[model samples]
Target: MLLGIFIAASSAGWAIAQGAALRVPDVPYEPTPHNVVAQMLRLAQVREGDVVYDLGCGDGRIVIAAVRERGTRGVCVDIDPQRIRESRANAAAAAVAERIRFLEQDLFTTEIREATVVMLFLWPEVNLKLRPKLWRELRPGTRVVSYVHDMGDWKPQRTMTVQGRYGPRPLYLWTIGSAPDR
Candidate 1:
């Protein structure tokens, strides 16, 4: 999970003194630990030629790691511009910026159909809300990995416990179209 405070705003948007409306993020940023990031990539079985999308990517660690360690191209999506900047800087430092695209927009609105693997470290409700989009957009056999959250009623292909910053955390993996539609 990436770390940051997100102020929830109306769908219509919130206006400041400048009269410009801002679309607030649905979740806060709490970066996934480095160890968990490694496990997520392992669970997803990312490899070369794979396109990895990390929704709510904080500091772009997951995508950066995949690009560096697994030779995969990646996209980092975040609703907050600050987080996007941090991701870009981190990716640049990791020397994988050229292989990663950073998008400063809502994850739900981002185009992810091309992703061969999707990584998420979001809230439980957000994960549930994102399920249909994953099912509808991702092609068959596309792997979806989530850290510390499960899509309710959607059985995962695999689940593992990994040592995290706090303690052991659960990671989940689901291959698109592998199980019955929920």
Candidate 2:
């Protein structure tokens, strides 16, 4: 019955019944508009030699874009293997497969300390949950940019509003050292 499906479980309770080990706590996929994506990368100042990590990377657009636009390398992490496969296909189509590493793993546990820039478009609660990891792991001056949701309580260094196909959307940016230590 429901055994085959990995029901979205809460962080507090991980109910394992039939061995479908999947825990996705983020929001549904909503691709950041291309214009917004450009603005996000620009805000982070992604340049050549930079390593960008996209947490909960849906289709790997951010990673592909970073490599395609600025010759930077990128790592995209997603819990969904289908998304990882799609990411690989998209990277190949974008002609930047060599510059991207696609991983089908949990966003909260993946090691991204080497990232110079991290992009996100997750839900508000997930944003808050990820704040500590970003603060502790990312190096000082490492740029973290979010498409819509923001890290709660930890203020962004800069915030901007962009007009997309769906109208105005808020974007947030935070540098690692700007926030007080946990």
Candidate 3:
């Protein structure tokens, strides 16, 4: 009876997931808030010509900001096709469409080795699972910035409290090779 209930729940979830490709209940879309974007960008330390990758980039605000403000090229990855479309539109509106690429792909499986800077605003568990990948894939000098969450077992090189119009936000910055144990 327990096994039957488990299967029923699993089937229901799959059906719901298929019905909502743009957003699953557990995976609601959260666009980067303006204040958080400012904080994360600062933490990213993005420079001209930098290749920035934003995992789970909802609406592409961070990628668009990077290209527009810092002269950086960016790749924005999200599992939702709707988000990819939104990001592309946002980039075009920001006039950084040519500098940013929006991709609909799993963040974990995507290649980020070429990134000079990577940004994320994801669940803590997601970051934790991605820790080893970041360490293994990113170059020594690569900069990683996270909004509201920290990479597991990896201590940030710098942290800042960003006060915004809405509220106070904490941004964490990490460098790949500097503190492996963090």
Please report the candidate that would top TM-score against the real structure: 1
Comparing candidate 2 with candidate 3, which one achieves the higher TM-score? 2
Taking all chains together, the TM-score of candidate 1 against the true structure is: 0.87
User: Positional deviation of 156 in candidate 2, in angstroms?
Assistant: 1.2
Tens-digit lDDT track of model 2 for 37-122: 89999999999999999998889988899999999999999887668888999999888999888888888899989999999998
What would the per-residue lDDT of candidate 3 be over residues 1-182, giving only the tens digit for each residue?
99999998998898677644534522467776786787787777788979999888889998888899899999999888778888999898888899887778888789998999999878888889888899888988999998777776677888887764457766889887855664
**Which candidate achieves the best lDDT against the true structure?**
1
- Residue 80 CA error for candidate 3 (Å)? 0.6
lDDT of 1 by residue, 1-182 (tens): 12222343342244553333156678777889988898898889899999999999978899999999999999999877778888999988888899999888888899999999999999999999999999888999999999999999999989999988899889999999855477
For every candidate structure, what is the RMSD over all alpha carbons to the true structure, in angstroms? Answer: 6.9, 5.3, 4.1
Candidate 1: give the clashing pairs: 1-30, 1-31, 1-32, 2-29, 2-30, 2-31, 3-29, 3-30
TM-score of 2: 0.85
Arrange candidates by TM-score, descending. Answer: 1, 2, 3
Error of 1 at 21 (Å): 9.8
Judge candidate 3 at residue 150 and give its lDDT.
Answer: 76
